[model samples]
Target chain A: MALQAGKGLLLKADPIAAAFREEVKLGLSKTSRRPRLVGILATSSAPSKFYAEFTRKQCEDLGVEFILKKTGAADTGDLGEGEGVEEAIIEANEDANIDGIMVYYPIFGVQQDHYLQQVVSPYKDVEGLHFKFHYNLYHNIRFIEPQSLLTSTVPSAASAGVVESEEPPPGTVKSIIPCTPLAIVKCLEHVGVYNKILPYGDRAYGRTITVINRSEVVGRPLAALLANDGARVFSVDIDSIQEYTKRPQGGADTSQRRYHPRHVVHPSNASLQECLAISDVVVSAVPTASYKVKTAWLKDGCVCVNVAADKNFESDVRDKASMYIPAVGKVTILMLLRNLLRLQQYKAVN
Target chain B: MALQAGKGLLLKADPIAAAFREEVKLGLSKTSRRPRLVGILATSSAPSKFYAEFTRKQCEDLGVEFILKKTGAADTGDLGEGEGVEEAIIEANEDANIDGIMVYYPIFGVQQDHYLQQVVSPYKDVEGLHFKFHYNLYHNIRFIEPQSLLTSTVPSAASAGVVESEEPPPGTVKSIIPCTPLAIVKCLEHVGVYNKILPYGDRAYGRTITVINRSEVVGRPLAALLANDGARVFSVDIDSIQEYTKRPQGGADTSQRRYHPRHVVHPSNASLQECLAISDVVVSAVPTASYKVKTAWLKDGCVCVNVAADKNFESDVRDKASMYIPAVGKVTILMLLRNLLRLQQYKAVN
Candidate 1:
């Protein structure tokens, strides 16, 4: 089991999970109708099945109904061949009973994302990957202060009557923050990592979090989320990990730098010695392949989130840190269910 | 002058600007109707006028007509008080000759983003912040390869009929990357920094670029852009600069740490002694107030982008680095024109 490696510090999320369930139950009762979620799985791939099944369990346990819409047809979203998926999306979009719609990502062997986004209405886009939803996320127009970017200091941007507005600082846009990252953050908070990091005893403020992968599903979104939440994110990937170590090159010119002399990345052997040395948290998404990392490199009791297929950390590394395994994956599902239920209630009232 | 700092290194955007004009000219000639752009200056703010005029000059220089629509309305998008703006958008959308529509951002003293997004047609959205353009950027669906995120792990994500597809790696989803960051990148590349850092002399593949502010407009977007382009981004603001300076805490635990133990920020005097010590590029967005940064902290020739209003660097600091000033901010205007022209051609062809 993924949790087996975390001798005792793995942070059994039972209490947080229970509280989320209670909140979802309360929200479900407040809704006008039963909050239903339709998860469309267009592939029977093992990973897809595993994730789909996990979602089903999380939803069922939270009193939300989950319907698995499976398709054997090899309809790719790229070739515009997702007729079945599109029809299903249209049906769900119009379904009054359905509060949210989540299409399992990476419809394996095919690409139907375009069709899915087109068919699924923004109102039901719980995944928030649709461009319509991104509008709210980007929030195009932001109020500039009297002293922000372009101001009255220069002869350039100081003439047409610009003034300051009372709008408070827009810290970060949360609409673009995806679920998996949110889940990891929630788990970290639940485990008291924020208490250690932030003065307010909440929010991941001023902490150094390292995202060891750059994938669309997890690393990319997580990095964005952490950076917005007032934490500095150091993102290192397989193609670019070697460049991140911040080697101590004292007054050294480019030609005389201490590292990467030949510019070749030794993937499995590349040492993130400096990165781990400073990181308060390490979220590793590199899967299966054993990476040469030592627990001593990280600060004591550092939070580790391993979102890989076979777990990104070795047993020795996992045992020393607090870890969230995406394969175990209960916390993120719980989080999504809680959000969906709350969104349903909001929809019902307004 | 901002260009004075980089006597030998200040990259002139003349060639890039000329190429962009040629592209726009070609696009305009290919279309049945002449390509025109509407510039909506809903405020008389000096900063807004300055930006609007700069854009007008660029457009006129490129043989494109620019019309400035001035309004001093205190309308809120959420309140639906932007009727005049909506009408103008409707007119622009219907006008086939108007190939692009540019709305000067932050109509000072009004909250009208929702109104603009709902009214402006996506085809005319030259800013690419519109949800329609973002769809191509977010690209809702992705194909799961047998490799990539995880591989060959049983009982993981392996059941729901998943299979591999032959799609090449998505080069980069660029619509979300705003113009300022792109301009900063172009400036850096033009200054020969990529050649200094990246292998094969192309792009910010593996360089450490520090963004000094966390605003929604510049710093946030720049960090995301740099990270996506494979650079190590260390973000710092006045409030958070102290936490970033890694002072080599050797099991210092909590008390013996070098800084942030008291959780108080020395805003005016806090030196980023450690951050600049390692950064290859420092994008400073803090305005008016000069930071207490020292020349000795940085290695020779660290690129600095002083986006601050009155300049954040001193003569001593500026003397050692290549800098870009918003006063001679032709790169961003050039980038936007390039995007608009390409978008125009794509719309015309499609």
Candidate 2:
């Protein structure tokens, strides 16, 4: 599954994603009905259209139901941009047959796009962008009673407090995490970045990572997920650098509290060079083609991951990094499918 | 307002809370009806009973309506612990006359009490423990459309994005923050810990803070709040230490995103001495009387705030600190009342 380059292993998303694909297939085989996913495309954007087609191909290959609902400029040439997106989301929300809903983003940019995100009911939101899921993601509320999604009450004793097990507790299910972040976590797990011997929530302990972006969709949430899992994360964006960690200077007594406060942030004044010098792993998602992480700055033998559509690492990245994952897109799609399956189960339980 | 002690100036909550008291009084005077708050005491715990009395006196002094609804063990000799607490909460939630609801803690300990917290409607939840408000606090969604509370959609363009203004955007209101955290922020603000000259939302920029204790109700949320406002906050709980910050090493390009990802967490292996040596401010809320932050470890001229009922700082705290605040109980009560006023406004708009 690993391709050895001149200096280090160059990894692709296929092998990591294949493992999840099998899991999804097995999940689908056991389900009573095929899970249906509705992808809403409302823009004339090239990337979004390509993504929609790509999603359709993946869904078709997996034998899951895929429906593309194009509106506004993406529809017939006469419509305005992002027009009828709300109605499309509402229709998908009301459709009992639709198990999951996903919207191709940047149709109207951040704020408007965020509103469209919320309009998708949390019950069927495959993207996991709804505020309910986002809240859980940020707070590290990993498992929840499926019934709690419909009502505020804790349905049973099993759902009373945080359960440390990876598998959901009795009468509870794993809360949906954002697909991209989940994909990234899965990638880290595949590459031995996550230490299995360590405790469940603190698998990334002792690792210092630098994630070069703070976009809500990927970088910020990914940083939070890693930090919550016990990593020292340097979240780099265009303006400033912030460090994320679960264990700060003085370790707290675990006996008193029911759950660990997931992670905390500390403003770092260190330069990119300083961060790169110390980082055990470097993940760059800078979208611009012009942006490149200097190979010379990276810590030798560190793992590197490039999440951008455009390569964000220099030609000689392998000279320093022990391993480099070119993209996480394939794994991300598998995560989306996985979420769809989970949402179906959620619906079934409710 | 500041009394010169043996070394540092002693700061009291009286002056700090007094300012907020006038603001609440003024807000009450302008309202058409007096704001009514219901405090549900369901425990025989001494602290809870004392706190209820304190809350009543404060409400009476401010000419606000206060109702003590004793249920379970606190009500009479016959009732079991936490009995009818959920019913009491539901009653307060449905009562048109009740503007806010606050339940005394440790009624049934962590999990059952957490469920009881969820039972309080967000509309009347002055304590801000409801998952909805906690979500907003953790995500740094400072201003929300008042109407957005009742519905999922954004009510207007004004409430679409994060607004940096201290004043709520038109048609929006400041999302309620947990009382203890808000009280700490206010204390920091009163003592000039918040730099007014800086841009809004980042007023705590460039300061390093250590917050001891990460309880869900106080420590964890306070750390998030401070970090969101651009302070580097070290969140110390019993089992672990976490660092919180909005800015990392390589700054994000501000032009690319609508809002900064509030804050990210990093697990630090640093000892308590290391954190204290660099911290510009130290706020401790450790509840145990035996738990005392060593004064000798503090950074010279640092500000110290004690938020626990029993002082968590050593007797010699003033030796190293430039300013010492003994307690924030008064400030926390005021913040609760302020939340009650805001909730009333929230109801009026809905």
Candidate 3:
């Protein structure tokens, strides 16, 4: 089954293009009084090139200022014999003219810790990955994370739904579901699949979801969010789960059985096949070069979501499958912009 | 197949009783200071008649003094009547010369809330039912609640394990497990069942456990405790589970076929039976004149825990059950004494 599954990018060419122009027009009116300078710092040419071009064009149309700062893909000199990315970050942090600063680390292997600590001021750090922000999350304090912001922008581009245009507005909260995973969940809901087993005709209850990852940016907080929606959750580390089941003497009792619907993390090609074979819905976040799921592994009507942009689609049963979603580019940027507008409105009122 | 489960009781019989006797002993040692006073307030004639005679004999043996405050059987207003009990409670609360105060309310429709506020001071509210103490529970602030103190007394005793100990050792943060339930859980543990489930098992991990009530004093907190111990929990109210599931159309996809092992709640006897039939372990807190569970309903070798004191045992099932545990009195008293002693030690050190 060649499934059409991937990230769902709700695109509106005319309306979204017009909305960007309108935001720029409104933003430019206030620029003379307080120059709204957006800053971009990136270690890779790819992300920097993409964001800089996109943001600069929007800024120009809105009459807002855009500044691009490139810290070439190299290690900080203090850590090794290489260019100092940390030094560039310090410069960005001290720049009084910058209204908002974004640092992009495109590849997974890059070590950005030193630069992260040195370059970002809490107020200007639009990503919200600073130590202070993380500590607040640990204590269950409410604060926006940059990833959440970036993920909402694309969905906000669609013409305001009836609920969106209600009095006082529904706020960005409803529209701000996690881009990749929420896209998968939304697809399931659209196709009359509510929860894992039961289907709701129209109104869907928030389904109990288990996410198996604890990386600072994704796993823990996502589990908390799912649990807050009345979902009983079990979050396990990928390595720990493997180690738990591989133990000698028939494994520990904890790994003996699966009694509930489970979500596994960053499954390998083989593991993905096993998970897809049993799951009603499968979501893959691993950045791979090709499709991990095989056509035969999925249940006939299962939903498959692929968020790995670099991955190629390959599945014989795609036509026979229920639905497949494809990944979209710069989806995070759209989400971030929507979040920024909401935050601005909140700050204005509160 | 009749299995008798071990049960334990905790009490502060040694030190507090010793202290009472010591006062009497010291007063009798002097001819001038021989007028030692002891008073009793009884809502039931049974305790008044029995304990009154016992105290009089103890006083006479030490050649001290004794006094009895009797609300006589005819004037023995219904314990469930809040106004009448409150009046007696206020009288006890104001009596200055009384060394210690004891108020007994029978289980026969006693309105505990009616007298609780008027009868107790934080210090002398030996029963720990006072508003200030109960409110502390809401904020998770620790204060003595007399009933909790009394119920915990038995576990405190059983924890001694046949050792004739007078006082708990200093600096003990006593684990005051509620006696009847603790005994039941411990009994199961002793039989090597649920041994793999540790003290800190996360119920969200999906172990099916059904608790038959949600009373904070017992059912709800115990459910939370079990869930914390890694058991998937199903809590049912004794009165509602049947009607909740049997309503015409079983509104809103409420079929047993949709039951997930994660967790469920049923509040009627029939639904509780359905849950029990499928459950690995069943905990009953339902107040019934006779056994609510029949031998046929239980799976062979299933663990049945009865936390209700008044439920009558049916001989057929009671004999064939893998385990049957009886409620032991005075455990709560032991738990309270240990807590008080531990508090005293901490106060001294800190």
Best by lDDT: 2
User: Please, what's the RMSD in Å of model 2?
Assistant: 17.0
Candidate 1, A23-126: lDDT as tens digits: 77787777666778888866546777778888888777667888877644333432221225544665676678887788876642112243344345544556
lDDT per residue, candidate 2, B1-350, as tens digits? 44565589889889998899999999999999999999999878899999999999999999999999998789876565665676688777777889999999976545335545656777888988775576577667788877556543222322222545789767768888999899999999999999999888888988999999877678878998999888888988776777888775346664543334577666667788999999999999988989999998999999999998899999889989999999999999999999999988898886
Fraction of true interface contacts that also occur in model 2: 0.03
Ranking by DockQ: 2, 1, 3
Question: What TM-score would every model get versus the actual structure?
Answer: 0.45, 0.55, 0.34
**Overall lDDT per candidate, in order of appearance:** 0.53, 0.81, 0.40
Q: Write the per-residue lDDT of candidate 1 for residues B290-322, one digit (tens) a residue.
A: 564555676577876666556666656656665
Q: TM-score of predicted model 1?
A: 0.45
> Which runs in model 3 stand beyond 4 Å of their true positions?
A1-48, A51-64, A73-84, A106-111, A114-119, A131-214, A218-227, A230-281, A299-302, A312-317, A342-350, B1-350
| lDDT of candidate model 3 versus the reference | 0.40
Model 3 C-alpha lDDT per residue in residues A35-150, reported as the tens digit of each score: 44454443444645665677667555545556665544432222221123434544555555555555555521222232233135444544544433332332222333323322
Residue A64 of model 1, lDDT score: 81
Listed in order, the DockQ scores are: 0.01, 0.03, 0.01
Better of 2 and 3 by lDDT: 2
